[model samples]
Target: MTTPSPSPRLAGHLLVECLIAQGVKDVFGVPGESYLAVLDGFHVHADAIRFVVNRQEGGAAYMAEAVGKLTGKPGVCFVTRGPGATNASIGVHTAFQDSTPMVLFVGDVASDTRDREAFQEVDFSAFFGPSTKGMAKRVERIDDAARIPEAVARAFMTAQSGRPGPVVVVLPEDMLTQAVPDALKALPALNPPQAWSDPGSLRSLRQMLLQARQPLVVAGGSGWTPQATSALHRFAENWQLPVANAFRFQDLFDNRHPQYAGDMGLGTDPGLRRRVSEADLLLVIGARMGEATTAGYTLLDVPVPKQTLVHIHVDAAELGRVYQPALSIQASMANAAKSLEGLTAPPDVPWAEWTASAHADYLASLNGAAAAKVCEGTLDMAAIIRTLSETLPPDAVISNGAGNFATWLHRFFQYRSLSQGLKIQLAPTNGAMGYGVPAGIAAALTTGRPVVTLTGDGDFLMNGQELATAVQHGVKTHVVVLLNNSSYGTIRMHQERAYPTHVLASDLRNPDFCALAKAYGYEAEKIEETSGFAPALARAMARRGGTLIELTFDVQALTTRQTLSGIRDAKGH
Candidate 1:
């Protein structure tokens, strides 16, 4: 009998094997000397996976977070110790707040260098530990090369389980090069089991719905499968309920559907806000009523709501964390929506007019935003957004960072299709300013589709260096920059709102954005008139590499509805 060849494996190669077994095809990271072994492992498994070389650790983390949001699986990222880990913390915090599943692996100093404040060393647990407000769900370090499989599997589990968030894993430089038996290969990645609601809770939810005259359904958070989204549609259609998506998750429900009630987030529809407050019953599904969604908790009374609250969440902890619900169903979105779809709505329900009126208010809000013509300014934001809405494909991915510039697109752009089986939105619910560029790059690389990123001058500069990354990767995305020459638009708007025109730190000085983009290998131009946008967008759509369109927006044009001069002029009105 021929003897089986002795299995030879390095810890880094073993880790890659485990990741492949778990179905991870892409990983974003910056190259580091500490993880040179892991880099080689990536080369060894080149046919199976790709290592996305990001310009900065922060951008890499953001890309990973976007992947997690798009796939509903834990997005994986690799970074080095100390500064690299710290730089990546922003994406970790974003995943925490956004309820995304992600795993961050940091290569650390050699095991012998422990606790001496070695070069590029950090206390992983202390830095990424869990708290009421912490970046990671769990932080762990693996000194034993043989234990990598276990750690990888556990990281996936921890990230996907209860209130899905990020997990941190630390690997010592010396240990990564250590040997692990090839026979002890990694097990497949684990998935969190779908938690189902109790039958009694479903019965109670049905009774509560029967007792309502004005019931509104609000959906948000991750963990929503296509099946769940379809079931939610069925549940809404069967009961003739008006549904709204919470915060940045506008794609959870089809916007074109008549039952849609618009998104509840920054610059929420006033009509929708009023409807939410006036409704007799609030059916919250898969969303945590956080500060932004609830308008700093003012929309819903804290411990108790003015309206009857029925909160259905994947995690049991989020149920009673905010508004105490009249009925709380603890189940995964897929299971909860499935259960809800089966419940019988009473034939004599009293909320028909209420639902119809809610949808009417939503339609009015959209019409109002579209009808208002340009009060002033050559580069009219309304027209620009209108052109973009008309030109882009129905399934086009819309990527944006935080700014007043986003207000224009958020108000006018309507997402109508799911090209990649997920929402086209790649915005950060945590309000990270530099999120758009990298997110657009990630979306383009993963989906192989046209990606559009709308950004302000300040927001663009935050992670604009990643344009070099896009150029290197030959990524094709349309980047629209609204330049209001020398001021942070959102902060300036807030400064105008609170302090009235003493814009101190909010004033920004920017480079020639067109020249900058051209230098980075993009087709770019500057637009000064409303009529220039559609042609620029058309040219971008036809371009080969990528395109950047810079529009000169007046600083006075602060928002979709109001201007800075208008805000200051009204003063105390």
Candidate 2:
């Protein structure tokens, strides 16, 4: 018996079918005339996959990036050529630096337009080059309609393999519209190949651990599953090592663990910094120890670290790219963690005292006498973060963008753990200013869980229009906007430190954030004092539709560590 041939279909529909076959449930993007056929394809296969319409390309890209970070799969996004691609580049850069897997599809001018620079045309490959310094890991254009499945499969693989990052695929408009007769089906969903730790390397690491009097474990980077995190927990507990999460990835280890050292990132605890610098052995796992995590590379010596660094990373290229390690293991997080946990430890290691003291420092950084002084304002940001940390569910997801305001969230909120089976924190290690709102919306829509987006007035306005997208999708995300009437709070803080007492372009003539949120069909209120926050938070959480809480604070509440006056006074102006 002869098998029946597949009927001819538009290449766009074939592309959508390929995506569905690859297990994509949701895609985020803004509509464009260039991809109308692809949009119609989404309508035809609406039951198989849902296309989430976003307010702008940037928000759409950020939402996709969030999905990548949350799900461990390649998050998908679509946008038009030229301006749309440029606008979405920020999220691509974020994904690259954050090491999250993401795929961005750019609908381009018709095939006939070629290289004549047609309307809204862009050389995507040139724009998003694949290199050590580029935005994407891979960039390709599909000129033939029949190769959609191949291009898409390759894109997904390239995004997720080794060190995860963003990939871009360019689809010409005319090629998408062309009908093709083919029986092509998507390749089976790809799983990244796991590289296990070498037995000799593990033995070497154990020897290093045995020789050290003081040791620290820095754990973070992408390609981690709940299983990996659990294995990491077991390994840390077995060795009695203090584990410090890298940069914005604070949830990789439970903050409540007895041996949990404070996070290593911006606004890191001073005691923890001292502890890291003083440690004799550094068992660095997964983390690349970028500028933020390494405190602008001042924490460790460049090229060759002063400490005995045993670095393990999935990608061999990253193992010795920044700092030369005494021993390097090229292994996936899961495999390395599993292997490490199997090593038998001595009844009592030498670092028990060191680990306990590290945990003590973490506790002191939280609220003990060693913690920084409280912000001077009616609406105390630190206290508010403490309330959020206490009131929210253990699984509640928190997201924030770049600002001095984010320092409060990072310093005060204690992240539970990814091993708890949820990714609780979504912030950009790249320090992008407009990531929180869209990321929170995506988290709520995808996970069906409570999400709180903390944003400064300037950060909120960058992608605040995405609030409408959340309302349209019936997502329950609470947004907290910290209003200080300054558009560039972080820049202003730096300015005060450098050129004391001179305020330049950082000040903002702002609008009523509550009214703006109300315009987006949300229940909104303004809270001026600390006394009004709890009740307002309860009301927001109880509402059916989403709500926005605008908290007002003075400029004196500059950061967790210092006030505006304090910064200028230090400069002695």
Global lDDT of each candidate: 0.85, 0.88
lDDT per residue for candidate 1 within 298-343, as digits (tens), equals: 9998899999999999888788997899988889988988998999
lDDT of 1: 0.85
Q: Estimate each model's TM-score.
A: 0.96, 0.97
TM-score for candidate 1, residues paired by index = 0.96
lDDT of 2 at 434: 91
- True-structure RMSD, every candidate: 2.0, 1.7
Question: Stretches of candidate 2 above 4 Å error?
Answer: 1-6, 368-374, 481-485
Clashing pairs in 2: none
- Candidate 1 lDDT for residue 142: 89
Which structure among the candidates has the greatest TM-score? 2
Q: In candidate 2, residue 351 scores what lDDT?
A: 83
User: Following a full C-alpha superposition, what root-mean-square deviation does model 2 have from the true structure?
Assistant: 1.7
